[model samples]
Target: MEVAPQLRPRAGLEVVAGDVGEAVPSYAQAFQVVVNIEVKPVATVPRRTPGASEEADRLWLEHARTAAVIDDEGCFLVRGADRDWVRVRRTAHTALSAALVPGAGSMVIAMSPDGRRLCALTEEDDDYWIVVHHFEDPLM
Candidate 1:
């Protein structure tokens, strides 16, 4: 789960042009080498309706018809009720209007390595990789 400066509730960080995929690595054409760093990995984000696998998808699709970047350990944050700081992976699916719905049990954002590709960061073979893909696929 990519944590950004915006993930912080009270601190006001300037909007800067950068991406974690770009900030920390030489992206493989396959996006396999990109790292997925956890900021608050201990989070257990509350469920809006008791489902992150499906409802989470609905939330993102309804807003922008894009894939969601789910933190493996996403939970309630100190600030922004139900709000979570998600690292947007680079992808073609961009949210037209982004929203944070803690009541629904989460804070969401559409992001990318370069802010242009749909990505899923996973731990496979004991290593993290930012896998880029279309927004229509599951995190499996």
Candidate 2:
């Protein structure tokens, strides 16, 4: 019996939207789909400030919830059931939440097409930007 040669699969694409509240104007949309973790309710904390994300950690660990925040350098997930603050880490996969860059305080979250890398929107000067990285496969 003879076997056929295998073919490579193609990557996926997606479009993401920023959180738009009732009072603020909206920003441009980002087209990406490498990694896409659900926007857990994340809480923001001061970068390098002492125990900044403690509150967010408390809620997540004690209550099992997530929050949306700009930066999450040293915060913990508040599960609402335990006293320990579950640590958060930068994913090798892609993420699209607002985060803190090295020196840019005002940067938008940019995800890779595959959802494996993370970057900032203001880092580039494009009208409609889409970060191309490794993303988590969605089960549909």
Candidate 3:
């Protein structure tokens, strides 16, 4: 008997631009990519409580939704909560977002030739670090 092949799941990044009031307060801008970039709102969470509205929760979600950016090459630049960059593969169905990085500031600089590592420039002492992000899809 012949066995059927299994289909693998797809994943990608979803980025949204939040309103100025909703964006998380930061001394530095939220997103900055050296390469070509596009910012779009990917998702939003409705007010959970019935007949209730919490501005804080709504604002937090808005900020979370705004911190992701993807390039044509399928690499993603996600700003983590600690103000560090989290690089990941751009999956088709999976939605990912990053919070503000800590310290003065940081930004994504470049992608490795092998498309495996990401370079980030930190504001403190003008330092830089290489980060490795694993993609769910090997081809991506």
- Indicate which candidate wins on TM-score: 3
For candidate 2, write residues 39-132 as lDDT tens digits: 2222333335554334323332222112122134422121111311112333332222122133442333322222233333222221212222
Steric clashes per prediction: 15, 45, 13
**C-alpha positional error of residue 26 in candidate 3 after TM-score superposition, expressed in Å:** 9.1
Each candidate structure's TM-score, on Cα atoms with residue i matched to residue i, is 0.21, 0.19, 0.23
What do the candidate models score in CA lDDT, each in turn?
0.29, 0.25, 0.29
Model 1 CA lDDT for position 45? 22
Q: Can you give the lDDT of residue 104 in candidate 1?
A: 39
lDDT of 3: 0.29
How far in Å is the alpha carbon of 75 misplaced in model 3? 1.8
Which 10-residue window in model 3 sums to the lowest lDDT?
Answer: 1-10
Off by more than 4 A, model 3: 1-28, 31-68, 80-83, 97-140
Ranking by lDDT: 1, 3, 2
- When sorted by TM-score, best at the front, the candidate numbers are 3, 1, 2
Worst 10 residues of 2 by lDDT: 2-11
lDDT of 3 by residue, 65-119 (tens): 3332234455443443344333344444442112213343433332322333233
How well does candidate 2 score on lDDT at residue 64? Answer: 19
lDDT of 1: 0.29
Which residue runs of candidate 2 sit more than 4 Å off their true CA positions?
Answer: 1-13, 16-25, 28-42, 49-92, 97-100, 109-140
Q: What tens-digit string does per-residue lDDT give for candidate 1 at 31-117?
A: 332233332221122243354434433343332223323223221111122322233322233321122323332233334323343
